[model samples]
Target: MLLEFVVEVPAEQVRSEVEKAYTVLQRTARVRGYRPGKAPRNILSHLYGGRVHADVAQRLVDATLNKALAEQSVQPLSQPAIAPAELRPDASFSYKARFEVRPEISGVKWEGFEVKRPSVKASDEMVDAEIAGLRRKHATLQSPDPERPAKVGDVATITFKLEIGGEFLDQKEQEVETELGSGHLFKEIDEALIGMNAGEHKDVRLTFPAQHQNPELRSKEGVFHVTLKDLRERIYPEVDDEFAKDCGEESLEALRASQRAKVEKELTQKASDAVAEQLVMEICKANPIPVPPSLVDQQAQLAERELLAAARRQGQRLDSNADLRARVRLDSEMKVRAGLLMAEIAKEKEVKVTEADIEKGYEELAEQSGKNVAKVKAEYRDPKKRELLIGMILEDKILDMIEAAAKITDAA
Candidate 1:
């Protein structure tokens, strides 16, 4: 770590440098029965002696090195290792500091990168399919005679006492509710409960699978004294005009019309999202650059926090270290790649975030969040936080620019 720089000092200023050290000694020196600054300079020197001289020497070295680095425009990555000239209380001071620096990157090309946008359109058939899904959602269920063992598409009610290591695990009485499908229990006590019959109690022992979605119970074993209380099959109601009126529509035709409009809006949003994704992916693929490791780590941390927050919202905990690491690694790499590609696009196009654009973005966000636009704006009043949000908005704008330039083909 060697810092080479040209140093210049006026002959008159040399005395001033020594004088500064003397001033420090006068203010800081402690003498017996004498106030620090009020003491005579001669008595202060005699009492404190070379200790003050050493303190002054250290200060002079620091100031000289700082000035030298600033004058030479040298940026050090770490604190400089300085070696000062011999200490002199009444003379000019000079020194050199050695340190590493960041390398200046150059000669990188920033032109002719291209990206593609996917073309999409909502079709009548798609709208019809969505309407059918809505109909299914509103379908009614009637209990059927339970003769056969429970299967998929059949709902079953069971009274189960779950235990692990001979300890009763199902402390709640109303434990076994409707099993939408196989192994729908909050805690997968055992898969043995599946296909169990009504009014039959069985001591079912099973091991928790390694691939269990709940990380805490993975690879653990538990036993359940389960009683199949009732079993019933699902019976969907007919999708007729009667069902349509039940859904708050005057007629089936009106229901279809409303569903069609809703589907169309959703499809439009999906299409825009697809276009944005395609554009950024194409741009990233075409222009490959080394992403900063620090940037990637930061993005990964952000993704982890977001995922953890989502889990908390759903009353779930991420207990497995492996699962957490996998999520962090995947999310970090994707965000870093996207960020690097977006930065390249912004640099090439000279894209900027305007205040008006941020305001418009705020309006859109407020609409999505079901909040007042002014309130949303007020939430982002902090300048640094507002700038971060503006940066995200501008990144979306960059993707839009690339999408606008792309030649799209309808893939629907």
Candidate 2:
């Protein structure tokens, strides 16, 4: 929705600006054969007339365009492109600026969209599994009973010396504690460790491919002399009163009730989120409106940054992937379009982000980040970050309104 925004400054205002610009320039501008503030108007015009006119024209445009836009209630998506217009004495000044504005949205079919709500409940088995997982997560390593052989699921501490291609890779044995079946050790070595008793030594062969990631191991045949120093088993605790107390619960019954409630709440939130997402997609499809290229570009940049950060975390590079970047740009365009639709929907429903919502948002951020409320507030003190937070709050409010107006069906 690019429109030409034209504004005409009266001749009197243009003359006033011209005089003001010259007055300021005359006070400080240096010229031959004349002291500052003592040069004649004609001389000053001859020396600095071009710069002064540009300055005055820019000043008049800046002073009047904002006022005109405010009076017309035109909100541009980004900065405007204004062609430089000449200013003449005893004549009016006018300039036309072009920029993207929100397209007029009409006939938006946004009500009573169909969505499916997943009906989820925590069963006894689910609760038991969850408690069992908790116990395993808190499990400890214990020495195996009867001094048996090392097997999968057991932690093995071993020392091994490697010789590759008729050369010793390590002058001394390397000691490492690795869990069997966890891929921490080489596949062949892990397989060789099974059914091995403590203090037993074995010799194994290994081959490295040319395309291997490590340069030292590439295209090499190797041998490993392994010694199993010890074997330990992972022991999970029993679900009793003592376990419940350790988990900050009064008893086993209380722990079960708490886990059931937590699981139920999680299911409810998931269903709500799914429904909202479906409704938003439907509404966006119903009303396809033109979105500004600048907004879409901003979204694409944000997506690219997020992708780069994720790649860095996994020790990978994504900058050279043109296809992925192109796909990201395509996805970002749709996100921008959907976001514009949601904002319009929010305006239509009179959905507002209140002070209470902001306070609640701050509190939730603090809880999620394990930081205090004051620190979270301080971190968002920058105007841009605070505005981003408010935008998120507004988005949530709009989604809630959409979900409330949707026709949701319960599903198993």
Candidate 3:
């Protein structure tokens, strides 16, 4: 874990640094009966004692550490721990730095791996389902008769208040519009809404699922006081050429073709991802590379931040749950290991990311996000972010190479 580096600058360089430090002190340090920038070196040293030497030593260590690491091609995961050393006026400066370097992964077997490639053809049934979904999206909502009760496939507008443990929950009385039996609400609540007429009130009790996203509400029982305010039926458009035209297609055939193409593309991407994931799993199992604790910890922190951001986006509060943190940490460790192995493979294969690759990456991002290239570039203004993007591009290229060299078999 400790990567040691030794750097010795010539006496001439040490003398130059000492003189520079003295010049700076003379301009900034005040002494008795001496004007600024006019103080002698001895006089400044007398006033400042070892301060000048300490400053010069620090500067020399910083400069030498960078230069030595570059020359030796050594990259550390953290700041180097420099051993304490004295700076003498007439001697060469020498210092030792100890730090943690990324673990070296050898004997990576990324080629000739056998993987199953799933067939990803789109079917007519899939196209029909997609078109049906489009028709439902364009459906019209009409108010049901006042005497009619809410039923499945009808949109119900309701105002509900929740009571947890017999205490009314604050800010729980809210109105929502949902289709009956749509699973948007709890199944019990959705069922209870059926056969309820407008202005009718009922109470539904339910227990939250164990795997609910909200940790506090998971497996908890609560009572909902519901009032059905209105009911509306959805009238879906007919699936024909007119509907296809409404969907920006010339004819029904064109619409189905477009949907089929979209489905095929999605399935192909999904299959590729599955193959890639399996390949990575196989590589990791074959080559058990030791991951650096620092890298794992860094990745874990990043994962935690992303999780918190996602929770905030959904307007949910996530408490400091130890179980969630542990799960995320474990996932992060695995990801870090996979990433290290991939990088090692990339290095061995001389897989490099060119300027054109980065530009293409940015373009793809912009296209997917519906943003301008300039906007996407501005978002990656941070140096670390830019470096991460380039690294990702390189990793992807390496993955492509691996897939090409892999022995693929059709999945049964």
Candidate 4:
């Protein structure tokens, strides 16, 4: 952890060095009370002498520190605190810095590890369930069982108002009908509405969970006045071969086969991704390196910004009152860990993204983004940007290489 840098001032150059700095300040200095390059050197010196002296000292220190660090082979993890001794008007300023250095790591192994890959294939039943979900999405509502109270899987119509401290935060309305469990409405209102005969009214007090997304609403106790207006449950008819034909399938078996095939394709991609992640983690575990906390913090900040932008795009407002710093800190740590782990794996495996690999990645991204491949390539034309994309591709290739070496078994 020992890092030392020397400050140098040549014996023959002290007077010239101070004069050079003074000359530059005279030419470049801009004072509010005087025109640029027109102010008297003595007047400027008198007006901003302390500030100019500090600035010049810092510049000289930065230049000397860089040279000293190079000569001593020392690297600092943080900015060095500068505390230079007072310099006489005729003497050159000089100072030295000593600080802790990041620990050096060597002789780490980062290859030849195995991981169990989870197997997932869409079954005939799964496909049928998905189709049923799609049908529900397209289903029309109809009044049924008017005599029964609301129950599970039944939609309830009720009028409710949110209150805080016995005063309503929501608009004051005698009746505002809304479906329970829809949007941000309480689930208990649905419970109370269900199985209740029409015209039945009740007031339910519910406590919001501490982890609620809205900081203002979190841990708040509010009473809801609800009146049961109506209740209805979804009714799904039998799905058989005839239903499959109506759904544009030759037969129920064909529909199930198609659904299973689709699921298998999706699962294959997912499993591949999971396998790559496991391999990277294994490699990183074997090859330990001290990643910079600053880099991790930067990654986390970028992620948080992206998340906020996405929320805005989706018409969701992020609460300024929420403790996002804690969330960002956790996210940044994870990202840093993953990055370090993958870097180790890439190093060990000699994994690389070839020109063709980058092209293929661009093609895939273009397809997903519904943009022309040429346009996508044009936007990422910079060599530095392309290298970053190549790194991601190389990481994936390394994961695939590890996955190929592993003995994968289908999970039940």
Quantify all predictions' global Cα lDDT against the true fold. 0.67, 0.86, 0.86, 0.69
lDDT digits (tens) for residues 201-308 of candidate 1: 777677887867767667888777777777777565566788778878888888888887777678678877877666655655665555555555667778778877
RMSD of 4: 5.2
Best by TM-score: 3
TM-score of 1: 0.66
Candidate 2 lands at a TM-score of 0.69
lDDT over C-alpha atoms for residue 253 of model 4: 86
- The digit string of per-residue lDDT tens for model 4 on 1-412 reads 4555557655335455556777777788887787777778788778877776676667677667777777777777666666675654567567768665554554445445667657776775778777887567645555565466656555666666667898887786455445445543567665666567767888888998786778898898988877776666666646778767766789878867777887888888888778766665665566556566656667877877888899889867675334786788765665565565656557665666678998899999899899999999998999888887887787677556656666565667
Candidate 3 lDDT over 1-412, as tens digits, reads 5689678878999999898888877888867798877888778778885988888889988787887899989899977889856789789988888888988778788888889988788889999999989989999999875568888999999999988898878675799999898787888989998988889999999998776786888899999999998888988998889999999999999999999999989989889998988777777777777787788889988899898899889866565488888998888877878888888888787788888999999999999899999999999989998998998898789788888988988765
Tell me how many clashing residue pairs each candidate has: 0, 0, 0, 3
Q: Quick one: best lDDT, which candidate?
A: 3
In model 3, the clashing pairs are: none
Positional deviation of residue 308's Cα in model 3 after best superposition, in angstroms: 4.9
Model 2: how far residue 360 lies from native, Å: 5.3
How big is the positional error of residue 269 in model 4, measured in Å on the Cα after superposition? 2.4
Off by over 4 Å in 4: 1-47, 61-108, 145-147, 170-184, 197-200, 209-220, 229-232, 245-248, 300-352, 369-375, 378-387, 405-412
User: Which pairs of residues collide in model 1?
Assistant: none
lDDT of 2 by residue, 1-412 (tens): 8988678899999898888888888899888899878999999998888888888889888898889888889988879998856888679999998988878876567778888998768789878877987797879998988789888999999999998877778799999999999886779999999999999999999897675667888888899999998899999888998898888899999999998888888888888877876876787677777788888888988998998899889866466367877898887877777778877777777788888999999999998899999999999999999999998999888777777788889996
Question: Residue 111: error of model 1 in Å?
Answer: 7.8
